[model samples]
Target chain A: MAEVMEKTALFEFLCRMGDNTLILGHRVSEWCGHAPVLEEDIALANTALDLIGQTQLWLEYAAEVEGKGRSADDLAFLRDVWDFRNVLMLELPNGDFGQTLMRQFLFDAWQVVMLGHLVRSSDTRVSEIAEKASKEVAYHLDRSRGTVIGLGDGTEESNARMQAALERLWPYVGEMFASDETDAAMLAAGVAPDPASLRAEFDAIVLPALAEATLTVPEGDFAHKGGRDGGMHTEHLGHILCTMQWLQRAYPGAKW
Target chain B: MVASVEQVWDWLDAVPDPEIPVISLVDLGIIRNVAWAGDTLQVTVTPTYSGCPATSIINLDIETALRDHGVEKIELKRQLSPAWTTDWLSDKGREKLEEYGIAPPQPAGGPERCPHCGSTAVEKLSQFGSTPCKAQWRCTECLEPFDYFKCI
Candidate 1:
């Protein structure tokens, strides 16, 4: 690949990584106090804050590199649904505490693998941010994994719901490590991992936990795709945008 | 005539949080000690929590504000050993926090009440609140969720 194309790929992948956290952070914040139980609610909200904090640095760096007047808030709030580049898996609704736990567990497990790989990245900015964020994410993943087991193995109803949630989210899982041209370039440049390499580790971490929870791992290679380059999004994203961007749109540039 | 610590204290009052914008570091009890070592003024400050996003900005704000007050050769030292405890919050700060719709740190002991409506019958919604220094809490009476300035 040409040097320019390689640079563009690195830029694009960084933005993808940044926007995923921003979008997911915004989504999880919706459950602030509306959670079913208080302890679980705190756990979810805390995790959400960690993701948002990590993404702030990532997005700010991305905007600086993009060399546009657009700030992270502009990219996060002003963009249309189609303009966002977050993964489809993250856009799924907060099904329930059980499902949310399962989702966080799955995502955190993958993030640990990705961040562990990312710390070795040649691109210093991304690696530096990932290194600082890795410590916070380790705690987040542990909390999520604990709750997932508690819910998945806790009761008949919970086990059934956990199983259903896992099956529903599984189809979208493969797309996570599907390295496109941008991913290829970032991997080659060492700005990001070769997503191709993290698959076994991701599976290894999650499968054993799922087995312990008495949860069945879904099968078949039929992967549902979308969100690599922002083709589409889940309906929940619209509501998320409405609430998140309300203050920004109401008074542009007003510090409140 | 010599300037007293009380006079120096008055000069430091204008240092508001760069992020929260409502409370001064004095109100937050982050301003630990203001003393003079020769002509050099030593300002000892502690952040509300480690890894708080606002610490860097707050440090800069303190330096600038004090310099504006004509204090020269200032040294800002961070005291992380005792760490920062919410017990440092002044009574006036607690009142201001309640009026501002966010709760103050629970009085240096047990049982943190809800800030929105003074109810001990409160539950922690999350360990993380709007910022890392806070814990999300909701009052059963008011049902309003508020940030608890976490005890260090």
Candidate 2:
């Protein structure tokens, strides 16, 4: 019974990691061919591709741990919004190019720190995945960090937009660090670090980047939760899944 | 007749990377292991990037190249641990990339010289290129845009 409980917790933890990438990947991919500049468009597409690829590795492992005979594709395409364990911020609409980059900067900061801890996970599978993912996340964080600073300090108009983006996204940031029973299980098993424990490192990376960008860090720590727990999600997720899973839902086992 | 591992390695070396055909897969440093497990030839490959679109094509190319060489029982394994790095790129691969008009990755986080003009004046156009593994850069001297194999 104890073994079964651990497996269940493991599955949940993996899903949280996978779903964050999948939902955010989809959101980033939406910017392809639509970004303000050609280079920016290509960069967004590549970032999206990396996140989706990471999702495959994470969800594949999640399915294996569940031992439910479900494949990664099933977990990704068949699941509804309510079943997703991603944070609420990932599902919110891309407000603008500035907003998108702000979101990317915030999430990349958290992900890089989180993956750093996971690279030493007691679970070899988790550690291996983290090892592979950390390199990519490092590149991502670097790019997002530069852009946030560049635009944040560029001009009056650009600075104002970036500041607005920060305020809008900051509330959702707290949820990423909020701990739950699943985190407790991961910490106890030495499989992963407590989400709250990641804050100091995340801040070390983020606070300076924001300060360099001339953007305010925002006031208060009021977090809107429930998304990661699979209780509630923003309405944007349903629309995203509608387009993302259309072929699978309609054709029922469609293939290339 | 069973081919020796060294012979298999030689045959695989001839197989070009599907994306950058100027360099072979071995030069790319993604083929991590090769061994004969029973009658099956197991070849391990690590992707340059997790979401690279060319991964499937690279796998198919490997299988095809081996099949053509008469290796009927071939197994391709994807290994993620010890992750693929730009450091794994062979010296020959670096030369090939430069000769093909693409700048090789540098530890300085950008290109040292232009592949087109060999000029030290170069600027990064973007952190990303047409593919996941490359970044866009241009030579100030020749004004020729080229791809730089990103260090990751």
Model 2 segments more than 4 A misplaced: none
Docking class of 1: incorrect
Clashes of each: 2, 0
Give the per-residue lDDT of model 1 (tens digit) for A35-92: 8876666666767777887676677777777777777767777777776777888888
Worst 10 residues of 2 chain A by lDDT: A226-235
Q: Per the 3 Å backbone cut-off, how many clashing residue pairs does candidate 2 have? A: 0
TM-score of 2: 0.99
Chain B, TM-score, each prediction?
0.83, 0.97
> Each candidate's DockQ score against the native complex?
0.14, 0.91
Clashing pairs in 1: A42-B125, A42-B126
| Candidate 1, position A162, lDDT | 94
- For candidate 2, give the lDDT of residue A5: 86
- What DockQ would you assign to candidate 1? 0.14
For each candidate, give its TM-score against the true structure.
0.70, 0.99
